[model samples]
Target: MGDDLNNDEGQLPRRDLLKSAGVALLAGAAASAGAAAAQTSASAPAPAPAARSGKAVGARLQGVQHFGLTVQNMDRAFEFYTEVLGGNEVMRDGDFRGEKIHNTLLTDQEIVARERGVNPRTIGVPDLKDGGQRLDVRFVQFDNVVIELLQYRDAQQPMGSGDSWAEPRDHMSPAYPRSMHICFYIRDDVDFNTFIRDLEAESARRGMTQVKANRVITVTSEQERQAAPLDANTNRITEGKSNGWSLIYCKGPEGEQLEFVQALGPVKKTFEDAMAARRRMLAAAGG
Candidate 1:
């Protein structure tokens, strides 16, 4: 839902940056997944006399319904998303039809960020060439997912992105891959340490160490829950060990790493498919 802030990266609203350091709000990295083997063609009725390898590939995908983020400040991300993550305001665009949808999404982000290695001289930005000037694109919603909050205020802004802890980043680094986070689940009778003491009282009322959270993470494997990708569910776990889901992580005011989830029981079952286990580890690493 945050799709790591719907594909987080940050900036173009200038100065003060930091939206990277692994996970930008993702509760148990959004619920510990175990769900697989459910749809036998929607109810075990139609596929009885099936045609073998002729059709039925897959892509009726229904999960992860929203994600997108580009923030550097749209009024401090609309006051930290409608006052500390309540999030709702499902609309708010800007001029030039938001720069023609921000240059048609920077032409699909210069072709899907060039296979995750990204180019354009390590994002030196320049109106991203022909597309970039939304300056303020909003769209928020929490529960069923949906997030889009860009700023790109006249481009040019990306270089070590401020919030300096010097060098810390860790959702295993490599600059957080899976299109970025948003896992906010927390509802199985709340009170996960009083939600990190109200996220350290909102990072001490925004003296802002990027609003805090980070501690609870417990996977307990099936190849580390199919190691995320193919629209990551971040390996759902919690069927035991006093139940599952449990997670914590926070940071927004630009350091942007969020997640605050809790399940504590019930949610299990997996036959381990996860996109054929990530295509058998990308065909045994021959990729």
Candidate 2:
């Protein structure tokens, strides 16, 4: 969730690029043409209860399965996530699926990147064996959530196209605000306050800049509105209804804009949750 990547304008910071790529990976895995076709063949009829009150819609995204990020050094990133953020190491290896994968875990770059649209072979080098360019990957689990850490060995590689920093003119993309960020949800405002305090304290201890922290409420499109809703007045929702989530925005060590979000409600929960739910419904309906 946190790393030492740069945050700068005009170009997608390496860390943000990695995280975004990771999400893309997860998306792809769930929606690939082959996966969709398989689901269509094995499709089953929905229970009447699940079809009625819509609770079935909410049952899909039960836990934080996994998340991916790119870092500068695998060893340092692995140590920081495990030691600093309190994640447990799960796996380490090389050449996953003959695609030159270096590390494999419940939460790894492959999982993250597949969620988006990027192919791992396009961005991941796997084991330094391919011209000594390997993506340092780590899978860490905290309770039910799985976090994947990815560090591409080559620093000079181009980030990607859909990235905000990499494509500023694409206001249609999420990173257009210059400070593209994501948020995670905590139990309540009390938990929110504690997280801020802890984050600041950690930042100070690490000699990192404590970036400004504030809240902003903005109107979203109908499609966007449906995915992550906000209360009209306070612009905040309950965590359970919204899926225990919140937001943490800060600059990584390399000056890359980063966002850690915790979900709390307005119709659907986290972006991933909502998307997954939609996919499930669509798959069930034979779409």
Candidate 3:
């Protein structure tokens, strides 16, 4: 079955690669953490959650639920995400039509994407040509939004230049300027900092180069601000206006871009907050 799906012209056996890499990456992370803790300060304080302000601007996101991507080597990618990045394999199954598929979930601080009445099929998967590769998606929940890793399997598949999976470099891709990168909000700055350090160490251990530190700026419109308070401030905006969002970008194992963000202020903390507000409005209207 795997070969049938993968061997087709232009078809890149990405899903299979993702599954293999996910398992190996997670295993490596667990082992590394244990060994590092044993050597490092065992007395280090337990990580703490960030403080939140009680201002209701709009809704809060639950964090990233799921995403899809393509990959070259499932086994290598699996090890990078699972062992090096600390993601656990939640379940393995086929897609909606019972097509064989692999699903893995990672712990993030919050959820980001919501069902904004968009058709799932439209945003769900891309229509690729025969043997064309689909987006290799990986999910990670964080404090503010879900972090998704997207890798294209077929080298011919045009991911913008410098993307994680662009040809030439198999594992690391040059960080592109102003590209769409997934951002993850963390609760405590301390924990967030530690997570970055861990990622850096993991990259070093795997002999991958860490890219220069660059921040991504986003602007939010007033309407968008009212809808998703968390992201509004982070969105790229004109100077003098509040740039609702800010993100520190990094790369995970196998060169997948990762973003760690700090909420602009009060509005973008929890996904539950957004849902609660909607419920309250609906109740007032007697819905």
Candidate 4:
């Protein structure tokens, strides 16, 4: 989640004595690519057409690099993401701690409170004992994005304390402030209902019993009809009147909220047109 360590070095072994050698590699290649794109956009000629069309002018970012989730168990989370969801395991690291890590993670609240002559507990800041806050992380890559699974260990809350929820809570509702959910865009060729049904069955077989897929909701063009429930195994869509989009909500192993969305009919066409316009804009900008 920290950006400061984009190029952290790791040790590699030799073929013979197993001597460790430092190798340079990207810790967050996607973030680095986004930064490069932002730099290029910032250097473009003043008042480009894209900027002129907007009211506010500033640096433009490419898009999201990854989503980070704190999980109760690293191994279980990895299995669900990679085995069940078909994500590729790209990287894994553990025991991330130290002063640099603390500062980068913004967990050095106690140090700041001490310097400012304030009680750390008064501000609800966890005491950073021994500066030994650590995190075990695994990166899983899917077709379009990556999800970073993290298990944190610190003096305030040790590892295996079971802080990550195993069940949903009231505050976790999407209506609550700061609540968020991960949404996956379904492929055009895939049947939305069939995908959800198969996903639920496979996830259960993989030991993610906590993962539950909700009923399919058809968001139609009719203003009076909203969230019409449809069978998860049946297709009940009308192309003209009731084909705006279809979606479903679910929960992951750690009670993380998840969503699957597929745009249909006019909505799909609008999305395609917007994508085409984006390509033309990028071409005109010499990107």
Candidate 5:
């Protein structure tokens, strides 16, 4: 995150590349959306139910346990997530395959059997007991959130025969449907621009190709925030005038999208303040 990095004009700057890539990606997504819209209904669908029931059912639910990802290599993913990003290694397991796995994962035994020309019960299991499914897994934690990384012996178009594991897909784009990226919070004490420059250097040293915006962006005006092409919920979190937010998007070791955000004011505080206000209201109501 250095100002001097931008001054170097000998070659194309990383930020320029990032901006180009972002523009291309957004343009492609827009074109794809336009083509899709021509074939579909214009109106948006109704919002999904927030809970299964009105009161008691919703109250029983807790927060998310973890987010799961099927990765190509477990060790590589572990290194990128924990070593590079400073996540805590929580738990790990290996060679997850069995009849119980089939049931728990809801494997389509018949379909797998037909595709492989094998018995439904013995698809992945060589001894003909359970489908011979196998996978390696690890869990990494960032504060309260846990990310479960898995390397599954692919169910379809598997790379290896018998005991060997299959290779995962080679490429993914943020514009692709179902593609996702995770954002990490930068402490308020850290200078966002400097942190980004350092992050770029460190990641490059570790053989990652950075795709970051040229500069840290902060919304300075309410009109700019309102004009942002974002949904309402996201706007509240990232685009408000009092938020004092700056962010940059980049890529992980395997080209997976990643984001870093620094907030000078009021993002988390908004939530904390609301909770405090609720407590006061409840106290006043004698509840």
Candidate 6:
């Protein structure tokens, strides 16, 4: 799935991974509390509630429950997210002996076979010695956002770059539309420049690959909207003003593109909206 984890489907991925002995402190505690409640309730027989006229189960989607990305190195990925990036480790699950990836869920059989080993069951063997592919996953929380970082273990093939699959080093390839990235909002209290400088310093000290200490830019549409044409036709052009301090981008472990963004200043948003905002930010930040 490249760094994208590429499971753009609405359903959350099944967490069949074996859990680590020391799961994330906070989320673990929360889960344990919930488990304790369930156990206590189990001891006493409680009557099943009658169905109501209210909305059905899992109906009313709140929005963006969580997203995940596949990583090659577990420790490095954890370090960058929890330590360097300053997010809390929610929980860790790992050392799974079996994982199920079916053609029914994902259309690409080739990706399934390569990323996840062949399903021995499909071959008529219910139990195989190899135990299919192994997986280790951890969840990280950034306030409202939750992210799952999973590593595919015991696989013969490499993940290669999912985003770059269509074109070398290309972040966006229509071939893999499921390919995605996550961004973090910089707190208003923090100085954007200082945060960026520290990130650059840390990246350099750690010798991070695919780091872009550039492309940090500011954007504002305060003045009349300006257009930059890709060709002669205005349809192909990117429109917006690159002014007011805005956002920056960088790559995290597993080649996942992460971002730090400042709240947009008052300006008329162009049709491109967030896309135009990003362009203005990058150009203003001067990468």
Candidate 4: residue 244 Cα off by (Å): 3.9
Where does candidate 4 clash, by residue pair? none
Which rank order by lDDT, best down to worst? 4, 5, 6, 1, 2, 3
Q: Can you give the TM-score per candidate against the true fold? A: 0.28, 0.41, 0.38, 0.62, 0.55, 0.50
RMSD of each: 19.0, 14.8, 18.8, 13.1, 16.8, 15.3
Please, what are the lDDT tens digits per residue for candidate 5 over residues 1-287? 11223313222133222232234334434544554464456575432476334435533334357788766555566666765566668888766567666555645655677888986545433221253546667888765467887665644423322223434345666777888887766554544555555555555656555333333235566455334432221212346655666666776655567777654456556644654564454334322
* Tens digits of per-residue lDDT for model 1, 110-214: 555676776643443325334343244678766556678765544343321322211223343225566356666554443456545554455456555566444
Clashes of each: 22, 48, 62, 0, 7, 7
lDDT of 3: 0.39
Clash pairs detected, candidate 5: 1-196, 1-197, 1-198, 124-131, 124-132, 125-131, 125-132
Candidate with the larger lDDT of 1 and 5:
5
Pick by lDDT: which candidate is best?
4
- Judge candidate 6 at residue 211 and give its lDDT: 46
Report the Cα lDDT for residue 44, model 5. Answer: 50
Native RMSD of candidate 6 (Å): 15.3
Better of 2 and 6 by TM-score: 6
Which regions in candidate 1 have their CA more than 4 angstroms from the true location? Answer: 1-67, 73-181, 184-191, 209-259, 267-287
lDDT of model 1, residue 168: 29
Instruction: Indicate which candidate wins on TM-score.
Output: 4
CA lDDT of every candidate: 0.46, 0.45, 0.39, 0.57, 0.52, 0.46
The sequence of per-residue lDDT tens digits that candidate 6 reaches over residues 1-287 is 11211112321111211111112222434444565467567794432355222435532222355688767666667666765665677888754443343233234544555566876334323221243444567898765567887665544323321221111234543236676667665543445555555554465456565444333223244121112121211111123454333565556655677665544343213322644454444334321
What tens-digit string does per-residue lDDT give for candidate 4 at 1-287? Answer: 10111111221111111011001012233344554477678984455667655633322434456899877766777777766565678888766666666566655676778888998655544323344455778898765567899876554554544453222254566777788888766554556665665566566666777787665444345332223332543334557644667677788887789886766687666655665565455444433
Judge candidate 2 at residue 62 and give its lDDT: 32
Which regions in candidate 2 have their CA more than 4 angstroms from the true location? 1-65, 94-130, 154-174, 177-183, 210-248, 253-257, 260-287
- TM-score for candidate 3, please give it: 0.38
